[model samples]
Structures are given as structure tokens and as C-alpha cells.
Target: MSDILFTRTDERLGEFAVRPVRPAEDTALLHGWLTHPKSAFWLMQEATPEQVEREFREIAAAPSRAAFIGLHRGRPAFLVERYDPAEDLAQVHRSEPGDVGMHFLVAPTDTPLHGFTRAVIGTVMELLFADPWVRRVVVEPDVRNRAVHVLNEAVGFRALRTVSLPGKDALLSTCTRAQFAAAAGHAPEGSAAERGANR
Candidate 1:
């Protein structure tokens, strides 16, 4: 598709692709995912379709920010947001130069595959690192989200500290290219500077 910007193939899984999100076309689908019980961590369990659309629309129009749909084997399976942390997490975390903020959520599925979420996150890291200027990937996930905390650690995110945001306490974490290489048990892919590239 014209919007597809990045692609990766997991050794065990199939292909993972990322494309700019089309707010109008994805409203209904995104609404379903945002309201699912498994997505409670996203703080939009009661979101209406209109709310979902509006939120994505705002994200789409924001400068230095973008929303992408992650596709697995050509089917939309997840959501990813890339942004400048200096503005998004400005009040909470002190962002360094070349830092990029990221958020990812896997769509709830009844037919779940083993290690699917991990693979998706890994691929996402690879996708981010693909850009040469991305020196570090930054994330501020809710502190109570233990599952995501574990995943962050698995991907080499070292928690800097817990900080209070507008509505929740968050664990500010970061991962560099060297750190990710160590965690992924592989050498650096390409000239990875960290905010990241496909593995």
C-alpha cells in the first residue's frame, strides 16, 4: 500500500508491516480495540467510535507525531504511535536530543499466537531503529502495567524512574541501540542509532 513505510520478518512468525493510519477508514476497527477489556491500560475502555476517530484525527494532524497501523501477514493487528517526547512527555520526563517516544498496543484477539506480542514489539523496535537519527527510544508506560514492564525489560528498556503524569504514575524507560543489541542477543542491525530500524 502507498502508506506502508516499513516491513520486517520474524524468524518464527510471518511478516510485520507498518503503514500510516487512516483515521476515517480505521475508526470502527480502532474503536473496538480501544474499548476492549484487554486494552484497559490504554485508559479508553469506554471510548465511543466517534471518540476514537477524533483522537486519531488529532494525532494524525499533530506535527512531529504520527500513528501507524501494524499489519501481520497483511492484516491490521496493532497500533503504534511515534512522537517527540520533548513535547509529549515534556512535563514528566526530561528528554535528551534525538529521543523519540513510542507507544504500541496489540489488538485483542481470541486466536492468540504464542509470543505474538513480544514479536510485534521487537519488530516495532526494529522499525524505529531503521531511521538513522533515532538515537534512543523512549517510553512512559503506566507503572501498574506489569505485563508491559516485563516486555520493556525484555527489549532492554531500563527504567529511569517513576514519575507522576496528569492522570497516572508512569515508569520512564529508555533503550539504546547497544542495550537492545544485548537484550536481543544479536549484533547491531545496520548503522542503528536506536530510536530504531527493522531487525
Candidate 2:
């Protein structure tokens, strides 16, 4: 698809592909995900399809933000939003150069895989780092979302401190490229050949 950004396959999770969100065509599907009871942290439990459409349309039109749909084995499985932290998070947090803000939601599924959510988040981080300019990934997850805090640590995010946002107190966190490489247990980009030599 023209919108596809990249495709990756995790040994245990099958193939996952990401593409830009289509506001018109994806409104109904995204509305369901955002309103799911399990998506309480998303803070849009009562959003209608129209509201979802308008929200995503605005995101799609914004120059500093982008939304993507992640597909697993050709089926839509998650939603991701990437934004320039300097634009939205500046008021709440001091954004450094190369900071990128992210948010993600795994679509509610009847058959939930044990580590599917982790894989989705890992994929999202990798996609962000694929850009040469991104040196750090920043996230401000709700303080009440302990599950996500655990997940964020698994991906190398170190929680800084609680910060009050518009409605929720969020745990500000950051992950650098080096930290992610260490946690993910992979050689940094451009070190693959060096690893072969060392071995």
C-alpha cells in the first residue's frame, strides 16, 4: 500500500506492518479501539466514529504529528501516533533536541497473545528510530497506568517524575537510542558487521 511505512517480522510474533492512518476509512475501526473498556488510559471512552474521524483528520493534517495503523499478518492490530514533543509536550516537559513523542494502542482482541503488546510497542519504537534524526523517544503515560509503566521499562524507558497535565498526572519518561539497544540486546545500527568480526 502507498501508505505503508515499513514492514518487520518478529521471530515469535509473525509479520507486522505499519502504514499511515486513513481518517475516512479507519474511523469506525479506530473508534472501537479507542472506546474499549481496556483502553481507559486513552481517555476517549465515549468518542463516536464521527469524533474519531475528526480527531484523526486533524492529526493527519497537522504537520508536526502523524498517526499509523499497525497490521499483524495483514490484519489491523494496533494504532500509533508520533508527534514532535516540542510542539505538544513542551508546556508540560522540557523537550530536548531529537525528542519524539509517541502513543500506541493495541486493538482489543478476543484472542490476546501473551507478548503481542510488547511486540507492538517494540515495533513502534524501531520505526521511530528508523529516522536518523530521532535520538531519544519520549513518552508521558498516565500515572495510573502501571501496566504501561512496566511495558515502558521493558523497552528501556526510565521514568523521570510525575507531571500534572491537563487532566491526568503523567509519569514522564525517556528512552535513548543506546538504552534501547542495550535493553533490546542488539548491536547498535552500523555495528552488525563489527559484531560479526568480534565473533
Candidate 3:
């Protein structure tokens, strides 16, 4: 069986999994998604499968960056990545010690799966919070992606500001572990009831 990163079923959602990208096996699918109009932000309009493989291999070989393929019930469905903004695309953004840059692209589907995209975002947040080193998660989605704007808000990501990047103007957003816990149907770490009315 393939290695999986996450496998949980929330009552409001369905089972999902995340795995590191296998460039050699997934390049064609990535090429198609990156070339599609909906994925214009990815900026690989003319990319061929070979180019996709080459690019993804380079990403996998990078030291401060990591990529993953998200699967919904064992089928590939999206690509996600995380990196250090200070050394990656936004070296001049004046990053802090806890800042991490993130990017995600949901693969086009034959039939749309309701709430699946939101679930993907939630799962990504869950992954981030799972790591104690990550106190905050940051994203630089294109300023024009209104759909993602709303979804991010639903997950407690507050807009920080708009900044210019290599290919587009990005609306910077952030989400902390506390914010995610609240959005994911959990209470804050400390509370009167949970602490049994202690001081």
C-alpha cells in the first residue's frame, strides 16, 4: 500500500489522505492541471509532461521546500506545497522566524465533489498544526481568487495584506493553531470546563 499522511473521516466530511509527490508517476496529471485555464496562477500554460517532470523533480530536490499530493479515498486529487518565504519566492517579504509559505492547486475533476475542496484546506491546516514547530501558516493566493478568499475565511485565515510576487499580486493570509482548532470544531487549549474550574 502507498504511504499516507492523513486518514480521517469527520462527520461533516469524508475520508481523505495526503502523500508526498511522486514526480515520475504524476507528471502528466500535473501538466494537465497546470495548463488548464482554472490553474492560470500556476503559470505553466505551455508545459509538457516532460517539463512537468523536470520541474517537479527540481522541487523535490530542494532543501527548504516540500510538496505533497492530496488524495481523496486513494485517488490523486490535488497538489500542495510548503516552503520558507525568506528563501523561496518572497525572499524580500521580510519574513519572521515562524512564517511558512504555502500553495495549493485542486485538480479538475470529472464530477465535482461537494465540500471536498474545503476539506482539503482543513486537512492541510491539520497537518500544519500537527507539527509543533509551526505556530502559524501563511498563504499567498492570487488577489483575484475570490473563492479561495471565502474558503480561507471560513477556516479562520485572516487577510494580512496584498503583496507583489513574481507572477501576481498575492493576498497574504494567516492562520494560527488556535484559530484552526476553533474552526475545526474544537475548543481552545484551556477553558473553565476542560480545566475543571481550576484557578
lDDT of 1 by residue, 91-191 (tens): 87788887899999999999999999999898888777777677899998999999999999999999999998876899999999888889999844432
Worst 10 residues of 1 by lDDT: 190-199
Instruction: Please state every model's RMSD to the true fold in angstroms.
Output: 3.6, 6.2, 7.4
What tens-digit string does per-residue lDDT give for candidate 3 at 1-199?
5456555454565666677778899888888889998888888898889998998887888877777787777788888888877776565466777767778889987888788888788777765555556677888888999999999989889998888888889898888778877786783221111110000
Clashes of each: 8, 0, 0
Error of 1 at 33 (Å): 0.3
lDDT of 2 by residue, 96-156 (tens): 8889999999999899999999999888888777776789999999999999999999989
After superposing candidate 2, which stretches have Cα over 4 Å from the reference? Answer: 187-199
TM-score of each: 0.92, 0.92, 0.87
Whole-model alpha-carbon lDDT for candidate 1: 0.85
**In model 3, what is the error at residue 58, expressed in angstroms?**
1.1
Query: Which ranking of candidates, highest TM-score first?
Result: 2, 1, 3
Off by over 4 Å in 3: 89-92, 187-199
Worst 10 residues of 2 by lDDT: 190-199
Task: List the candidates ranked by lDDT, beginning with the highest.
Answer: 1, 2, 3
